[model samples]
Target: MYGDVDVPAAVQRALTGFLDLQQERLEAIGPELTEQVQAARDATSGGKRLRPAFCYWGFRAAGGDPAQPILTAAASLEMLHVSALVHDDVMDSSDTRRGAPAAHRRFEALQRARSEVSGVGGDPVGFGVGAAILLGDLCLIWADEMLHTSGFDAAALARASKFFDAVRVEVTAGQYLDLVAQASGVSDMDQALRVLRYKSATYTVERPLHIGAALAGGDRRLIEALSAYGLPVGEAFQLRDDLLGVFGDPALTGKPAGDDLREGKRTVLVAYAVDHASEVQLAEFDRLFGRPDLDDDEIQLLREILQDSRAVRACEDLITERTEDALDALDRAPLADDTARKALADLAIAATSRQL
Candidate 1:
């Protein structure tokens, strides 16, 4: 459902191989560590593999071959993404992910089960949180290791590493900004967009493209062009995600509806609603928008306010505008491979389409 590049299978194979090897290594150190590795595997499994799709097609666009090294390097993005998701779930105190118990939640359940069987007293919640943090850190470390061992030429790996490192720093900073915005309860679109760009745009698309291009020894011109196309599409992807958080079906999204509202996301959709809401609507918004105990009826009420204020429609327009801009940039990207260009074109639509 992504780039139509037939690479998801290959990416999955590569990821499985790496995880298997890492699990063996972990077992050698201590069998008790198996659960952490299993958690990593669980976090890495499923999802769209969008980051790897972006990286693989980016490499192909820059004339990289469908070789092992490129595929392995592309698969490394999944590791980094897993690290983010595990930590993000912990930070959000989310109970579920990908339609299953979140990492911390899973750990918490395990702790509870052990306590019940052993009749022992312990801090199950704290243990779960601590274990999840270490698991997240392990994923981060392994992601770097995977990239370095991906079999690319040393020179190429070095070049790609720069972008890879930048993505980590930028995403961390973006997460910090998001936390700040939520804490301050700011409703400014500018702050929301800033957080969006740093938290998601670069990591999801721009730097992945850059890393892929660097691995292929692509020149500065190609890297810049890919960035031009990636950034806006990335923004559109996140905007659509914000919409889905409130309006999407749980069956499709693997999340409860209005979870973002309960978390006080401070997304652009909320900002628009705040700006456009009438007195009565604003009063209702203030009452139900961010309450942890927000009920289904209140969610429906907020949805009505968002719709009546045209925030949802305005966000849809922005998504469409950004998608068009991304396609236009793709057309002018100077890619020599027609197939690569077409794949990226398909990806732009997939990235921001309603079905996502």
Candidate 2:
């Protein structure tokens, strides 16, 4: 079941410790700025810490010492992820995150309270969004600063920087594709795969692994092998997330059921269902997709339609296929240690098997 890979207890400690270090750095910047940064930092506290863990394990897999520098660099990635989330929540107008008030919402509350006390009308939404945007930018800048100042050798720093740059570029491209597809709809499997590669796979898994490996002085061949394993696994992970967004229990996922349906995410599952659906089903989809006002019963019916159309089965099959591809790549990779390999394998399983 769980704990299939004996992840080093020290590694886990290092991850948290690095996070604390970054928090301290953020707080020290200024007392006036501390509240915003602290809010941003608190937003990240409850995640699975998957990215940092991946970075740590990837470094260890390449025989790098889990020293201060490595731990700091790994934590930096977590900060970057937080930055992305702050911006994403604003973009999505999400009210909650990790089962709590989203950053912008929290700021909105603060603004309203201040306005009521002062008897003035301040644009809460605008102020909240502006603050969130700045906070996200600060996080990105700090992530780079932390990575650069981690005392790695110049060569290692350069390599890691290049890898981070690639990650940023790929993730931006992926996000653009996601937005485009949401607007235009994905017509075929090829376009859907492109979305998967750019939006989720490269940033979520491949680049994180590569950055860790690069920091540890891994050879190009090793990095390439890790990327191969990461791509399909990451895609599978996102696909599972897509399913959960539509079908998962709200208590488990910290989101309302059918949030994805409301959001109109052009996921592979939706695309497959639309392609295979009958005319009536297609009409129902067109009516419900992206409609925020749909009631619970309507959402339930949409789920039923998805099940009836066998899109659920098709998505599950794709998960299986992608998981197998990831494992196959791992089998052929020239990993140096059994622990690292086992951890990667367990991660692949855990990522797709998650209920929330």
- Cα lDDT tens digits, model 2, 1-356, are 21332233433454456556666776687666666756765765767666766776778778887544676677677777878888877877788878888888888888888999999977999988888888888777767876787678889989888889988788778777777887785436667778888777887888888989998889989999998899898899888988998999888888888988888778888888888889999898888888878799989988988898898999999899999999999999887767788888988998888997
Candidate 1 local lDDT, residue 153: 82
Per-residue CA lDDT of model 1 for 191-310, tens digit only, reads 999988999989898999899888888898999999999999999999999999999888888888899989988999999999999999998898787788898988998999999999
Question: In candidate 1, residue 288 scores what lDDT?
Answer: 81
- lDDT assessment of candidate 1: 0.88
Superposed model 2: Cα runs more than 4 Å off:
1-31, 185-188
After aligning candidate 2 to the native by TM-score, how far in Å is the CA of 10 from where it should be? 7.1
Q: What lDDT does each candidate get?
A: 0.88, 0.79
**Candidate 2 lDDT for residue 5:** 29
**Candidate 1 has what TM-score?**
0.98
Q: What is the C-alpha RMSD of each candidate to the true structure, in Å?
A: 1.2, 2.7
lDDT of 1 at 251: 83
The residue pairs found clashing in candidate 2 are: none
